[model samples]
Target: MNTRMNSTASEAAHQFIVIEGPIGVGKTSLARRLCASLSAQGVLEEGAQNPFLERFYRNQRAAALPTQLYFLLQRAQQLAALQQQDLFAPLRVADYLLEKDRLFAQVTLDQAEYRLYEQVCAKLDIHPPKPDLVVYLQAPVDVLLERIAKRGVDYEQRIERAYLERLNEAYARFFHEFEAAPLLIVNAASIDPINNHADYEELLAAIRRMKRGRLYYNPLRSRGI
Candidate 1:
């Protein structure tokens, strides 16, 4: 998903916000809710439009290349459009980050395929709009698999637990090295930011208070405070 950053003068701190997590972590739902709260534009991934997604889910190895390519092109186009115009000028809250594409490519692609993918990516010249803040949702692999089951998308039924574990680890590695913007890591296992109001409020407060570097919004750990 691609989002724009057009914030109210009151919220200069969060013009562009990105909510990221592994699959089925409710990050997209949080992004939409944040858009409502901030009166910002909502950018969602058009995953339904990806013809190869279902196939990729069914056969990741067989379909990884096309699936990745489709997503790459789609996200590039969406972000490029964001670059072109801001007439609507809605503040931006998005579910996905462009840089994370390489994470998936690394996990799913073999060496030669990854090489080709990188070459194509360089050609696309993707310079994503820098988000003012990134909200990363984290949950245990078991929790992720359970959520995926609860959602019950047809193609997602084919997803394996091993893949989820691997994806989670990859995300961990990426965010560990991430230094592009202010980072807010949320322990999504214990709190549901999408459905629980108290949790959401706590997260909102954390967002308001964050000034620099990496911060965490773990309510369970803050019980004593």
Candidate 2:
């Protein structure tokens, strides 16, 4: 255990912060930047490294359950680790939510498999720490496809545009009724939080001002950046 005191000055005031979005929507990028800006530790999901992922991309029907199970177990372990961390720390940013596991499972697994998976998940004592803020990035299917192609990951090359479209819709529907945390919905179609410091600063400001409930941010409609 890394038993360093939770330095008050370095603490993020909000406890846990999470950045979530569909594949290639810049969740990891934003999470990394936020962690760096807040001088906090980051817990990022290891996506491409999953052994079953490549095979799943090739044949989702045959590989969905194993891939989903791998992810569920991995995320559960990560959350368990997070639960043991010092809460007094300034900030901790994570790239994924345990609940979001169901989104993929529903989309990929059949009815019977999904039900079994849910049962296994229920038996696990993995309860994630509640995040004070959740930044949900949204982008058009075209934009997501373009970004995914630009990244040039081999496994990701098999991702069809149609699949991404459905995934985006699923996310929109999921967040539409979500009330678990203070949600900041961002239109990431045009904003480049990595290279554009102005855009990044604007998002940081929005996060700082978040008091409760949900807020939407569209960089294309915001003031001069």
Tens-digit per-residue lDDT, 1-225, candidate 1: 223335443366667889998999888888889888878777789887899999898888999999999989999999998878776555688899998789999999999999999999999998889988898999998899889899888888788999999999999999999999999999999887777788888888887777569987777654342
Report RMSD for candidate 2: 3.4
- Local distance difference test, per candidate? 0.86, 0.86
lDDT of 2: 0.86
> What is the per-residue lDDT of model 2 for residues 1-225, given as tens digits with 9 covering 90 to 100?
333445433333477888988999999989999888877789899987689999999998999999999999999888888768655554688998777899999899999999999898889868788898888999998888888899899989899988888888889999999899999999899788887999899888888877689998976555465
* Model 2, runs deviating above 4 Å: 1-13, 221-225
TM-score of 1: 0.91
lDDT score at residue 194, model 2, on the 0-100 scale:
83
Task: Tell me the deviation in Å of residue 157 in model 2.
Answer: 0.8
lDDT of 1: 0.86
